[model samples]
Target: MSAVIESHGHDDHHHGPAKGLTRWLYTTNHKDIGSLYLWFSFAMFLIGGVMALVIRAELFQPGMQIVEPEFYNQMLTLHGLIMVFGAVMPAFVGLANWLIPMMVGAPDMALPRMNNLSFWILPFAFFILLSSLFMEGGAPNFGWTFYAPLSTTYAPPSVTFFIFSVHIMGASSIMGSINVIVTIMNMRAPGMTLMKMPLFVWSWLITAYLLIAVMPVLAGAVTMMLMDIHFGTSFFNAAGGGDPVLFQHIFWFFGHPEVYIMILPAFGIASHIIETFSRKQLFGYSSMVWAMASIAILSFVVWAHHMFTVGLPLAAELFFMWATMLIAVPTGVKVFNWVTTMFKGSITYETPMLFAIAFVVLFTIGGFSGLMLAITPADFQYHDTYFVVAHFHYVLVPGSVFSIMAAVYYWIPKWTGNMYDERLGKLHFWLSFTGVNITFFPQHFIGLAGMPRRYPDYALQFADWNAISSVGAFLFGASQILFLFIVLKTVMGGKKATPQVWEGSRGLEWTVDSPAPYHTFTTPPKVSL
Candidate 1:
């Protein structure tokens, strides 16, 4: 493929970014908004990481050492909320803003001002959420799921704030999804057909649609919660003709797709990184796209799997169990494609590739664990156990978070025109890899040993594995500081990079200069097959 740039002189009139805070405060530039999102996500990751460390510290032994059980629950709740809404999701949105326009050969996001609004509102939402910790009765403690009666009747005064913050976040996500959909649907350069677009672009397009479909469901769920809390309704109150299980129904309806929403982009990122480092065109491109679509479609039907232990009917349990297991077919196809792409290729173990490979392996481990939990009989045992916790943390930490790291390493050169410290980059990867495995892998054993999740204290038999997990957690948390330092060091100064920073890189984004211009594809570039 070749791209012919059709430049216009006027497009170069204001080719540099503004010099002050206003550039970020009021600018509609996609790159600026992308940077804002990335920086904000990093900040949230750190805050959430601290909360995680605190949880781990208290659980470092059999007894609560640093925090009371109430505070521990709050930490657990806030950590999940911040990491999901504030860290992983925002980070992907940031990547979408940065890469999608460039990959699709568009000038910028379709709704630039809306993109700005989408990102700016995020910090305020989190501020409201974090402020709840200082409120009377403390922060939300009903777990991140915030199940019915707990979120409504027994919840602290801060639950109202949490609901309000969720509204803000939902609004932001909806707007961001709209921007992504419009940009991709309307802005691809000439001849850059749907299949011709990069896999990353395809992933975001699917994700945006999923967001539009489910974000409203989430909004409705939370709205119902608000009404129940304030207006004396019983939407989820069994005491007032509402079934508490109804909350699980509504929440999981949003929650399960929300899981795919987080992982789908990781799939895309892995595809690109794996292909690039393998020095080969991705194997099974069409199959990969269809597989992702299949997975997305299957996500809606699998929600009940999470509720199997809620005393669902036998038929309902079997239906959900089978539906959940069906997801593995497409997911397995993705894993196969990645591995096949790497087979017989001149693969290099770059920092990005290392992370991507880890994503494939570790995410598959998470996937198999998911299959275990999909067995209705097995789910009965695993539900709410540390095993469940182990499964998701594997999926999320190594699965989503590691993919994000891969993307940053793969594209930071294009964004900054400087090569990062390769030595430190690899060091970060190894430490993170070692730390994450040491942290979560042990939980599988302990969880099977009957340790429950969300508890500040555990029985003596669970102590050894919990201690190992906590130590690994601290190691994993500390390694991120090294990641931050490496990124900052690269941004400050490093070896200059060429347009095609990686020898095997392929995409419209790579066709631009290293440190892509303030405005790119100002006049649509014609793509050739």
Candidate 2:
């Protein structure tokens, strides 16, 4: 393959990317960086999946089987941290790096060099985090949320490393968000207005702002934790004249919007897939943009809902509960628009569409469960149970994870210049969907029956559901191998795809050559709705 591929821009002297390992190290190309982000995210996904298996294996029966209680806690903490930070966030950023420039007819991200730096820093961050698992006291086992005294007073020697690693990751996220904001705000092609931008771009625009707003809060929280542990500050220490509840306040303030940071890009992805597969213009394009913005705004206020059982005032509980519930309004608008887009239109259940539909249905289930948990009185019953586990997994796995898969299936043709095997793709989808339900559905029942979360051993009464859930988890984990195989096979070689890979697709991204050129729209192609 030639290092230089011809781009659609007027420049005839453009050169292709360099070959070999050096291509990744010093390159500022958005596409190469995007590829790096995607591959890195996949590796983290596999690593996290293995940790999850360790957890499920232990919980498969009434007693511990695979690992000790301490190790189990490590696995639990690492799994959550890796999946949220390592897999989901980076994957969405990769999509933004790859598609946002192309969709908006820009040459590349505004801060291309910073984009490269941000991505490269992630490995070290996660490396430091994972290395703590082998340290003398084991990894930070206070859970991914790392609530107050557990992360401070009783924490391991490795907690210092964990804190530094968190700081690094937060810095990376902040940088990535800045690059996205600059590129989207300043680099659009002439005549391309905000209202004319694709839903994906709009979603990312809102997401980028949310990331900028919240990542600093996370950094502050960790810094406070560091002071509490090392310098004897009592920001979250009751003995030192601080309130432990304050930690939850600070964490959730950042944590709530952080959840949206993972899912908003997914909303963009589902919108594009639904509209493209349905052969219709998005039913409520303007409203969809507003809805995403609305959701982002509401996210900041609802952070306390997660801490409903922490003895907040009744007024505070009512305020958080209603604010949290209000998010459903904008979210519901998005779902209704997707269905409306699909209504009475020529619909095809392609691989991407399959995943998109599953995301909608399963994510809604998560959303409804979230609403149930938002009820102050009801949350006291549901707090820290497997029901909470089921809720987030549904949102993240099928919700965010499925959307990432759908984006790959929907756009791989453009990225690779080859069409994936439809049959294999569908098979992967069905297996994943079934596996997810099998794994998570039983959890809901067990949780309702009073199975608290993060326990290595459960009473015999919870044994059947635990075993069944573990089996489903193993099945789901295995199905991902098929997904990897399908992706690799498609990349190796398949049917060649045309410029407009999907007939109904409409965007500047599809206007260029298939397997999109290394440099595209260098001359700033004109855009019009």
Candidate 3:
């Protein structure tokens, strides 16, 4: 295999990316598509960040000063949708497109045309979703989850558009997942066995399976919503022999796994970053793989925990409580692996390491809060409150978002052949770190004091913390502008990078050129490990 790979003729048919607009539109090249996904996700991140600033500005005072209550609801709804569907999920997929083939020694994604189709559909999906705000009834105000009667009976005329957009997004996700699974399963270079594969590949493979299983469930849930709205079906309409709780069950059935779908890749990324900076082979490599697989499987059975506030029978409540809490075991195993990997190793706190460490600590805080929410009785106290918002944002912003940022910092040098300004990167990190805690830590107290989420106004008692939170929100949002600048600065020009960008980095990816070639592994490379 090694001889064949070495003897194979280099396919010079590949030149660099096509010039101009046609490069993005018609190209099936993984690198080009990956760049497209990353840029698109970043644009959505900025748009979503603006919506968040609006929400925080409204909450800056005790009254609805900045916008009308209706507009406020639209901001919150669009923020959630855009961040989840448009930013976080797509960013991970973008990472997968760029890294997976390199890590596995595949030349390209298994279905190249399908990959292009999957990515191209996203802009259209988001276009439909955003276009809804301009529609007569305004955007989806019922929240990203789009729970029952509110989403069905009381939803806007744009709900139909929202439903269609969701279908398009789901289709995109499913196709992307299929492409990932096929590439990983069948395209590994010779000698690159399953256990020897990097943690990022493992994480994404699990995530791909999870996506394949649940994206359809989400599509079905929305289709049922469409039917309830137009066809007069009672899928969620209690008056017509359907139960609203049924919608919660269906939505959450997809929603629980959906949360893991976003974070599991983060887990993968943290493993690589932690191991790299720690200057050690990853601790518990097999265990990390099993842990991710465990978390993905556990995600399925824990759906009902989100619906605990709604009327669930005693047995079902207890079942979900135990199931949700059980997920903590594998999750703890992962956190332990990261820490143990770093213990007594020559660790360096570079920008990626800082974010990875933050992901570990902050994500654990969110996990503990999640455990609190898992307790059926306690959730009754915390459900629908700002505390819930705090918990998820902690998990998402610091956990997933931080990890994504870490990946960009860690790999951008390889992608661009230019090192980002390390001082500026750390500065961006500190601002983000400070801003995130200041913004969310206070929400826990306000939530405990009986302030609910999704409200445009708050009581006088909630005024002060809300003001502080808004300040932090502004800081966090502004820091991302620095991030965008850093990325562009790195891409355009900076200190030149070596093939092995990080001193201790280990992977097939690092073996390639600094800015990996237009074509790689024309002949399947023989993997040593």
Candidate 4:
């Protein structure tokens, strides 16, 4: 009888999640942690969007209408930092936490407790960062890049807080990357060979490697700044015999890979979504894997492209220019594979597919503009201009951000055991698509007309396009609220979803019950291939 009672208690432990707040606080379950990460990232996205709206509002009429120049600088700096580190990167990590285990048929992340720690630390890091706004000297104003002397010598007292916060963020990312690598390497079920794994898993494996390689470099850069600022070192100070340009080299070495780290997972996501809606096998599967590997490898060699105007020798300039352009080859290969997958197929334009299609078209346009900037001579003119701003925003907004939206729409049903409202999902996609193009397309023209970025006021000649751009920015910002609503409503309740959520869906993740049981794969499922 005692043995029987013990067995009953053991069964209770695996039945479902615990009640209320403790479930979130002490849980090691991947799905719960994933939900936490996603919700936190969305909150950050909204906050960052508010900061962006403030900037656009100030830039609306080009006369510093809403904020002081100093405050404007603060908003710009925080906006970039929050959106990249807080919004985009965290969102990708959240997706990884949710999807990677199921894709590989693993019971849970290899380091589940570490996953919990990695996620929980992020809020504190950003809190230290955001709290700086209320301090005496105000928040950081050296721009998100935080080039040396500006960040060290002329920065607000809060720069140290920024450094500390950055360190915490890096630590969180490194821990998360390590978890992904270990889980992928050690936890796959029988017969799931590397090549046979889904593209999303493959994308994340490469991304985890990239994060491990560069996040430390970012931490090291900030550490040097800490020593330079508080300890009187000359890492980036010309007065103390340190070279400022060296700072850019270190930062971009980390920065360029960081860019791929943000988007590689998106490549994985787009492949799955496009294949599902196309009702066809993803074309060039092996080629897609190789293309992603090539992009990750090449990311290391092209860091100097962002510094073309920084007075490097012609030999260095030529090398960096050609290398930057070379990245387009593999990137183009991926694009070709995605497009070819849709050829001669029964395609459906669901919300996920629409976002995937937009990602292909818009990301290519961003890629073309990037090629334009890759010309060393052309970059000299475009450097620090709104053209550069347009180039990256196009890549990030429509490229990385859109792929994330696709994944959310594609998978939320599986997550909640309920299908989202189709009309509302489609509505959200079109509003976002229209708003994204409208907000960013005008910046390309105004940037070409010589409007510099990071300024509070501009010449009247630049007024009209800026006004149009600002209006588009607000439209884009407001539409995100609708997205938030849709996600929340779907989570609460909707039409019941089946185990296989979509008609063409194919993965271990889809084989489970909708809303997935609290503990999945307690006994590893067999993989046929």
Per-model CA lDDT versus the true structure: 0.93, 0.93, 0.94, 0.93
**lDDT by residue for model 3 over 1-529, one digit each (tens)?**
5534422432436567789998899777788888899999999999999999999999999976989999999999999999999999999999999999999999888888788999999999999999998999799999888988999999988999999999999999999999999999999999999999999999999999999999999999999999999998999898899999999999999999999999999999999999999999989999999999999999999999998878889999999999999999999999999999999999999999999999999999999999999999999999999999999999999999999999999999988999999999999999999999999999999998999999999999999999999999999999999999999999999999999999899999999998988778768888887
The runs of at least 3 residues in candidate 4 whose Cα sits more than 4 Å from the true structure, single-residue gaps closed, are: 1-13
All candidates: CA RMSD (Å)? 3.3, 3.1, 3.0, 2.9
Tell how far residue 175 is off in model 2, in angstroms. Answer: 0.6
lDDT of 4 at 162: 98
lDDT of 4 by residue, 1-529 (tens): 5644643454456768889999898887789998888888899999999999999999899676888999999999999999999999999999999998998998788888789999999999999999999998999998999998889889999999999999999999999999999999999988899999999999999999999999999999999999999898998888889999999999999999999998999999999999999999999999999999999999999999999988999999999999989999999999999999999889999999999999999999999999999999999999999999999999999999999999999999989999999999999999899999988999999899999999999999989988888888898999999999999999999999999999998999999999888778777889995
Residue 32 C-alpha lDDT in model 2: 90
Error of 2 at 254 (Å): 0.4
Which ten residues in a row are the worst by lDDT in model 3? Answer: 3-12
Reference-based TM-score, model 4: 0.98
* Deviation from native of the Cα of residue 492 in model 1, angstroms: 0.5
TM-scores of all predicted structures: 0.98, 0.97, 0.98, 0.98
Which residue pairs show collisions in model 2? 3-16, 4-16
